[model samples]
Target chain A: MIGIKELRAGDSLPEVRLNPVTRLDLIKYAGASGDFNPIHTIDAEAEQAGLPGIIAHGMWTMGNLAKLFTPYLEQGFIREYAIRFRGMVFLGDVVTLKAVLKDLQDQELTFEVAAVNHDGQDVLKGSVVFSAELPDL
Target chain B: MLKDSIGKRSEKVRNTIERGAVRKFAEAIGDPAPIFIDEAAGAESVYKRNIAPPTFPVTFDAGVIPELDLPSKGLIHGEQIYTYVRPLLVGETVYCWMEVKDYYERSGKMGRMGFLVMTKYGENANGELLFTEERIVIISEAVRKGMGA
Candidate 1:
């Protein structure tokens, strides 16, 4: 139902607010991602690794963004999405997800996406590219 | 710290980013896209070859820099952005280096502290610049309540 033309530069997606990271979330993410770095779910282990405490997987945060774009790119519009880990996120931190249209081509659609924490820090900075043509159902 | 006699940047550490590692990443997230799995399907996509998910590049030999690490109760998932020079193939053996591109601090409700973390990556198997991914992250108390703390 969503079309690329509907999204334009400065258009904003519905705001996504997620629950704070809990030990359970980390455990679930570890089980799902199989990252089991120990630093993410184990408090002492994280400290030993020179980290403040248990942190969340970078992908988990990116997943929320993927979820946000799913409705628009549902059929096959999204070509790619990605991000690099800059800061470590620990249990209990709140992250805000947002996006803005950057450019659109008859061949592809693109936007700039970012995740900001409670402190107004841009936690994740990346782009999402989508196919301009709609897929046939 | 003493300067090296050769004056060359010491090989601090080499993070071997591999498919198996990325496979873990894809598995950790439960992404079953054919391109991420079936090599043939990826090759056929507009990207012209079997490619990992967009995030795949991050796991390919990512080198983390210090100071980007913030002291906190835990690391939080913040913002993520990716641009493509071309889609990555499943077994292309891509290599990358990560650096702390930027960092800053500010005052806020949690008592005057804010930070931004950024990293850039250069990719290749034969030393070619494929694409660059600059990731930015922020840390603050405002995140606590906003995330339902």
Candidate 2:
């Protein structure tokens, strides 16, 4: 993990990957999120709704992206963060989340983040605003 | 049917941020960030207590006075945007409010689809702001038709 001072404007954060989104993963999410939308939990219902079996909740992918920034969250100085869902994700799709330093101020840093699937299709994209003291630098 | 809610904002609903729920959320997202799950580590970390990941606001709803009584089925989550005031702390009570900000339509590969843009927020018990999550829900024509069923 790089310290805030070690990060350059174009530094890339280590990517987080989740392979083969499974049906059980969606079930756990449905339970944890309290979002029991059948499109995400039941395979047959998803097909009835014109989807390719059960789909991943958009928040699931976004939450994976947050995992990439979990180190920062541990230190507790994140000032702002936001994301936009750009594509759909289905069961069995491998997902990857990435981020790059966008800017740096006296004590703050911003980064553009993305989550993409196996075909390089976007699932989510967003940015975060964080300001914190250098801890291990 | 949702068009009627274009600018309707719901009354604020209050809820407490619980540590157990925060840990469940962390595990569900597969994020093992110590500050979000380990109280011991958190006690030594910056916040001195477990905190939630930025996207954890998805679980904080008591009930929204929905202005749009649209069909719940077949409505997909199109997009979501979250802006933070600071990281939310576990066991902190906060007030949440929601509103349908816009209603529009566009051509979809399937057919006509409606977009309902809604914004929700969390504020500390003292009335201080915490975070805002603006979400877009897409209702396909199939969903529109099923509303009467």
DockQ for every prediction shown: 0.21, 0.51
Quote the TM-score that chain A achieves in each candidate: 0.89, 0.90
lDDT of 2 by residue, A1-137 (tens): 66765799999888878878998888988899999989998878888887877889988888878777777664436566677777888878999889999998877888898898999988888787776652331
Ten residues in sequence with the least summed lDDT for candidate 2 chain B:
B62-71
Q: Could you give me the TM-score of model 1 versus the true structure?
A: 0.55
Worst 10 residues of 1 chain B by lDDT: B1-10
| Over 4 Å off, model 1 | A1-58, A67-108, A111-127, A131-137, B1-20, B64-77, B114-116, B137-149
Interface RMSD for candidate 2 relative to the native interface: 4.2
**TM-score of chain A, predicted model 2, versus the true chain A, to 2 decimals:** 0.90
